[model samples]
Target: MASRTAPFSPFEFLIAWRYLRARRAEGGVSVMTWISLIGITLGVAALIATLAVRAGFRAEFVDTILGSNAHVTVYSAPMEVVEGSGVYSSLMRDYQVRAERVAAIPGVTRAAPLIRGQVMATKDGRSNVAEVYGISAADLQTIPRVANPETALGSIEQFGEGIAIGSGLARELGVGLGDKLKLISPEGAKTAFGTSPRVSAYTVTYIFTAGRWDIDRTRIYMPFAEAQSYFNREAGADEIEVMVEDPEHLEPLAVPLMRAGGDGTLLWSWQDSSSSFLRALDIEDNVMFVILSILVLIAAMNITSGLIMLVKNKGRDIGILRTMGLTEGSVMRVFFLCGAFTGVIGTIAGVTLGCLFAIYIDQVMSFVNWLNGGGVWDPSIRGIYELPAKLQGADVAKAVILSLGLSFVVTIFPARRAARLNPVEALRYE
Candidate 1:
């Protein structure tokens, strides 16, 4: 008699496709197949979306920090200077030459000297400690968002003895533009009755919001010349703040900065200043990745179970094919294709859903915030008021590959079991 089975060339794939599309009555896909597909889809989507959110948060945090501060700061080492009047002063003097040299460095974009000090700000009998930064108007523009004319009350040049305060700080002190406040500095003139803290009054010339609560609540900017006179440091600014073309590559500029600044000058990068915080963020990202990967692993297990059930269901059909001269390897390939198809389809669906979710995450967060009366992340409590999400192509690719790879690997054992089945045993009852 002629063989009943079709040739292996296209028959194996054809049979697999027919089996996948077949109805329940025709011994086609079972409920487990759908369940496994859903599992994989959810797993991949969750991983991609979660990773994108983490990356976004890290990027926003770094930008906020760098916006409020310079990429690098060069300052003279602490020195005890005895004035002509024999009064002792601890100051880092005369950084103009150092600033010029640092500005000439390859990656340096802008360099300006600044005087930084702490002072108690008093208004309406309410006192709050604040950091004072004194820089020229032109140099202040190079810092970051402060450069925008709309962000400040007016030009830095307009502020003679006046100061620019952050919006948060202004709100806290119950002060506004042109309002006068008292600033008490610890470095005071030597009096016969012990040293008295120097108290000076300054008009708030401008108001700025750096979008970071820390900066907005605790920082004030003044003119470099006025700050020098107020701090009694006629020598010059305390440090030179340097902006770079790329803040991420700050390490490469350190060597040249140090060389240019010469002896006693210390170069501090933004990374060095925020190392602990960045490390904490990195740890959080890693922990989240491991936790979310468990979902994908569970989905892979579902694929395994689904394939095993499929092999059992097709046993009689396999036995018939074997009797008709179908090779064991061909039988294995048929089942493998079935499982691989489910995996590939699920992975693609998941990738599409994940990318969509990441793209619209901001809007979702805003809606949630609105539902919660906008207190989800109060700017006063948290520096950032909104959740951030960035969709990276590499992250999506990794998630897709991982899910598909796991699915492919899990099919091997079940496929091999089907290939090793005994034709007579499978057909004995049928």
Candidate 2:
């Protein structure tokens, strides 16, 4: 009696699974499979981590620049005060009116007049050149660090003849709260000795940390009225600083708003101020992405080689299965599944490791610093000490898709080759 053999459900899948789990002695998956898997894993992880770091750096950089400066600055061409007091006064009045108009714009949040000038700060024989910002009490309150009462001097009202200096500047000058510091301005009183720089002693009302080394090292804040008196620019502010609801799109909003203020008004947005540097960053990021993607492509090529070797090694078994009525499509599916399985597993593992690395990059940097006896980022050399990393879901998805897609694409040649094997020739030598 001929016994009926029960069909193995999803025979191709079962065979493929068995092959994947086969031992080397049993003609199963070889070392090439492991090599391909590791290659894909490392490539995907590096890509994700790098992208995350770039995103984090961009975010932090934008925040730092915008926080330190205004979204838009409205000012006029530099004019010599000696030429015409009447013209200067009229221009100042127009600027004030324009500032008001700008504040009324749809997306405008705040607008205030500001005066910026260079001065030398001296205390205890130590002197450093610094930028002096003249701002009103209301305007000063809008600054992030300055807004904190603990970090700022008592009040702008109490800052008469007093100045708030950055913490770094204070440290360098060896000055503290209530201490007197001398401010020497190059544009000060003209004298018989060829316009001697104006020198004045100011009481240090408060010391503030701007959260950025560059700003903290070179900034001093003073009352607008006092600055006018000291700088002798009583005519008006040098420019108007504006804040907006959305700083990213500040240009479009700022341009039309400033134009509405009146003609002959010039405006500079934050983007315009930092365009070259920002463009460089974007170019570097794109170059890195392309470079990393090549690594994934190389890894995918490894997958292709691994599958080719796999098909060659299993040629006899494929022929036997074909003789047993397995269709050519089934053979193709079996090999395709094998390659895809490797990519899937590697992609998942890589994503997990990459996200963890991104999330904990700061701690990792700290550990490295500790290993190097600390001070990896010497304050004098590096403005920012912490390494930033931001993981975006879209970036991760892109990396995974790119890697898996490449892996799948490369598998086609080998999978199709396996399907086209001649059953008779394949089993002839066996």
Error of model 1, residue 175, in angstroms = 3.3
lDDT (Cα, tens digit) per residue for candidate 2, span 11-125: 6667777777758574535677787788889999999999999898778767766776788887775444467564443235455787888898888888888888999888778
Instruction: Give per-residue CA lDDT, model 1, range 144-259, as digits (tens).
Output: 75655225665555665588888778989999877998999997787899878999999988788776778888998888888887777677777888888999888788789888
Check candidate 1 and list the clashing pairs: none
The parts of candidate 1 lying over 4 Å away from their true place are 1-11, 22-29, 80-90, 149-161, 370-373, 378-382
The models' CA-based lDDT, in order, is 0.81, 0.80
lDDT score for residue 269 of model 2: 86
lDDT, model 1, position 383: 69
TM-score, every prediction = 0.88, 0.89
Query: Model 2 — TM-score against the truth?
Result: 0.89
Clashes by residue pair, model 2: none
Stretches of candidate 2 above 4 Å error?
1-10, 26-29, 79-95, 148-161, 192-194, 260-263, 373-383
